[model samples]
Target chain A: MTLVKVYVNYKKSILNPEAQAIHSALNRLGYSNISDVKLGKYFEITVDDDSKDIDSEINEICDKLLANVNMESYRYEIVEGANA
Target chain B: MTLVKVYVNYKKSILNPEAQAIHSALNRLGYSNISDVKLGKYFEITVDDDSKDIDSEINEICDKLLANVNMESYRYEIVEGANA
Candidate 1:
């Protein structure tokens, strides 16, 4: 099997309220130097190693469902082994 | 500065419906070979380098607010630079 690790996060140009809240919380917790506390989604997908067009398929899935193209961006890396 | 990367995910013993839904969607999209699609949260926290007890502080923040201990587990790593 192949392990596809995907990380999806809000675009840098966009405003993320959840991230702001977390940043504020960090400050309140006496971590004044803490900054850029962004939040994102991570997915660990396991797939058959023999599949053809795996890269494109992963791109399609991520673009169509895993991430919002306008506000969020996604990237993925494939690992040779599977721990799924 | 210190960059704390935290990954929070549902316990392996628990059922995650969101992950299942995404898996089904992947199958419908002709990725029948895809399996073990698990979802999780990724946080990129930027903090000061001079702080003492950084490890325990990160643990406190993660445990108290970043993760739901009953259903999820969290792990973190600290990088040596700043990208906040």
Candidate 2:
């Protein structure tokens, strides 16, 4: 079995409302030193080892349905011999 | 500086299409056995260490901006004296 982990996040240059809200809250809470608040996301997938096309599958998913390539960036890794 | 690491992901029970694509990819890659694929996200925020009220700030951010609370799940940890 192959274990794949994906991490997705807003582009660094893009404006994130969530981070801004967090910044505002932190400022109000007297933790004003918080410079920047960025939001990120992740995913862990377990796949059957019988197929050897995980990368293409992941690419298609990212391109078609999983993420908005224009706004979010993602990376993933496949683990070998893990939980096999 | 306080390092706050947040991990946001689809609730464990949610259906993840990204993972499914990867699952198919693995099967094509010749290393099948993967059962499911899930997508997740992360955020690493740096807050001013001088403030003792980071918890509230984080909470508000999570509720109002950082996470949807309705579909995604998130968690964060704040470090003390690590980068001071």
Candidate 3:
């Protein structure tokens, strides 16, 4: 099986409220030096060994259901010989 | 600033229905080689430079909020001189 790891984050042009809230909370908790506290999602997908073109196949899956193309940007890396 | 990345995954002892559903979907979509598709959460936290003991501080935060020790296993990495 191929392990495909996807990292999804808000587009650079968009402002994320959850990230802002975390930033504020960090400051309040005495982390004044922290900045750009962006929050994002991560997915670890295990693709079948039978896949012919694993790279493109994973990309297609990400575009279809894993990522919100409108406001979010995503990237993935494939690791060979992984179970999950 | 320090960038802390926490990867949370379900314990091996538990059964993850979401992962199973994804596995089934992949098979239906013709990915019969796939197996052991596990689902998990990821967190990227930006901590202030003012932190004295970054390692311990990040661990404290993860134990308190980022990870639920009951059913999830988590690991983190600390990157120095990063914003997020």
Provide the clashing-pair count of each candidate structure. Answer: 0, 39, 3
Q: Label model 3 with its docking quality class.
A: medium
In the range A1-84, model 3's lDDT, one tens digit per residue, is: 788888888888999898788777767876566565666777787766777898887777767766689998888888988755
lDDT of 2 at B42: 76
- Badly placed stretches (over 4 Å) of model 3 are A28-33
Writing each residue's lDDT as its tens digit, candidate 2 over A1-84 gives 677777777887788887687678767865567786776667676666665577987676566545678998877887876783
Q: Pick the candidate with the highest DockQ.
A: 1
Per-residue CA lDDT of candidate 2, range B1-84, in tens?
778887777776777787577567756754345476665657777876666688877777666666788888888888765562
- Per-model chain B TM-scores are 0.93, 0.80, 0.90
Candidate 1 lDDT, A1-84, residue by residue in tens: 899999999999999999899899879977786766989999999988778888998999988999999999999999977666
Identify the superior model by DockQ, candidate 1 or candidate 3: 1
Candidate 1 residue lDDT tens string, B1-84: 788899999999999999999999889977889877999999999877777888988898898889999999999988877666
Pairs with backbone N, CA or C atoms under 3 Å apart (clashes), candidate 1: none
Docking class of 1: high
Model 3 chain A weakest lDDT span, ten residues long: A30-39
Determine which window of 10 residues in candidate 3 chain B has minimal summed lDDT.
Answer: B30-39
Off by over 4 Å in 2: B1-3, B9-34, B39-41, B49-84
Provide fnat values for all models in the order shown. 0.86, 0.92, 0.62
Better of 2 and 3 by lDDT: 3
